[model samples]
Target: MSSISLPLGGDVRKTRQNSLTLLINRFGVFFMILVLSGVGLIVSPGFFSSTNLLNILNAVSYLGIVAAGIAFVIFCGQYGDMSAPMTMAISGVISVEFMRYGLVPAFLAAMATGLVIGAVNGYIVGKFRANAIIWTLAMNFILEGLVRWSYKGTQIYPDMATEKTYQTGFFLPLLAKLDRHIMDIDLVSRAQAFNGLATTYPLGVPLVLYVMFAVMIIGYIVMSKTTFGNQLRVVGSSYEVGRMSGINATGTVMKAFMMSSLFASIAGIFMTSLNRVGAFYIGQGYDFQAVTAIILGGMSLSGGRGSMIGVFGGVFTLGLISNILTLVGIGTFTQKMITGFLFIVVVAVNARSLRKLGRDYA
Candidate 1:
């Protein structure tokens, strides 16, 4: 009877306040996308075309795949993976070389190569406790050197002629008879529509875009709907806490790196498919691009928070900006400068938000 009613405490209030704060924090990236879209549409007429829109999607497709995969690693609190581009290039080269055997064989071989590279990244970063940035950078240099030495600084072009001939032998008749129109509209009748529309499959766009989309979706599901994803989040939040929770922190980080490398390799394959060529320098600086897309998607650089959808949005935004600049006939240097500036701005905003979150949590 002497036990009095418990009072509502400050800690409870603080917890409620933080919950609201976190909800708002998560929306910053999405809001930024809306704001950018509005500004872009208002400023540029060319930004809204079906063709231009498809082009943006096509252009962003491979990068989006890479960014989606790497977003997990960043979310896992790894500093960065510099070996992404290298992994891509190596996989591309392997895929091109294996094409002489057959498409299926070639693709499988390329994926295998990617897996190996991913394993290597994971081993170094996880087992050795190496600095992610430095380790990945060194691995990148090694890969580049190997590629350069093997190719003697030359580019390897996929045998499109052979590919066409093979297609003609097997797929030509089927493709020729396929319906092109969608809903009686000629807009989706084009080859590009196969990238998303359910009608006729475009020879190149279908394979590349569909693969990229599939990868993105899978990555999204893995990061958001799985036990592994939860483990990654915990590890990213704090290695010490994660370890105390009986999660293998190093293993989680390694898995993230592996996934990142695997995605990069897939991106490389798409690039080769699109370009019909593999260059030693292919995917140059794409690691940074992936990082930029991840950050712009609203992922915290400090780690443990991001989504595949956000990465896709960020990739779309970047592609839109780049395409608009090109359509306007902006010079290469000017476009790079503008893009770089925008990247800096977006990243700065995200960084500020992350800092605020840390302070609030503290």
Candidate 2:
């Protein structure tokens, strides 16, 4: 009899608490960010300084851009493109080499090549339902070997300071004056633009930071507001269900892959410009780095859940850790170890949560 009367609204109160817990769990990246920021401040007073923050943003912007692209594939339920790093590597190398022709041509060539690679990956994966990770890994190795062979196992140093001297007039006299004028203005101006890709600071902010944020904003809009985004979400959730609902699942996934490729290539250009060189190793570890960022950003490995804001949080979190570690004198090797450790922990937790929900951890 005493137990027969329950408190009024107790179930409602429990529901409210559950909702709060879910929100906390879902947005835990931001909370971790706050915690990490506090830790950074405690460890290094300069962690939040304008100069240091700008450096952090600059350092992570390339990865952030790459991560934003790879997130699309993750969103589409593709594990990831293992070839992303190589996409960046080859694209950067090509851009630098193409500069001999002209900067505009170089930029176009880099972007075009990246899209071609992405289109191939998307088509093969979508048409055959092949294992995306394995296929892309193979592609990565193949591209690596080609790059090494092409460059004779050396890094391609960009000629940022000089353009290739042209030999005109003798071979083609009719076009001499126009060619001379065209080549003269064309090479230097576009090269300046190319260098500015990474160097220009809008209001003392690295141009790459602006680019990274812009990509994130566009990505968010595409994923949240558009019809294709809706289809992508449905397809990501369940390909069969999406197909049944008249969605072009394969095409949708293909676009995601292409977007990822384009993003990687973009990162490649900036990174190459920053380093002033391109080589097989230019983007060596970006593949897993991007996935880690997206995953830690509150996205599930199995796909169909994430946000650009969450991805940005994840990217900043990694950079913050690096800056803090550097302030505390941790070297790059140790930093890698710490990062790899964190990645393992996050994936494990994600898998556990998925298991609890009786979901596939694909």
Best by TM-score: 2
Worst 10 residues of 1 by lDDT: 187-196
Residue 336 local lDDT, model 1: 69
Candidate 1 clash pair list: none
Off by over 4 Å in 2: 1-17, 100-102, 160-193
Pairs that collide in candidate 2 are none
RMSD of 1: 9.7
- Give all candidates' CA lDDT scores: 0.71, 0.81
- Model 1 residue runs over 4 Å out of place are 1-24, 160-206, 359-362
At residue 358, what lDDT does model 2 achieve? Answer: 57
Give the C-alpha miss distance for residue 130 in model 1, angstroms.
1.8
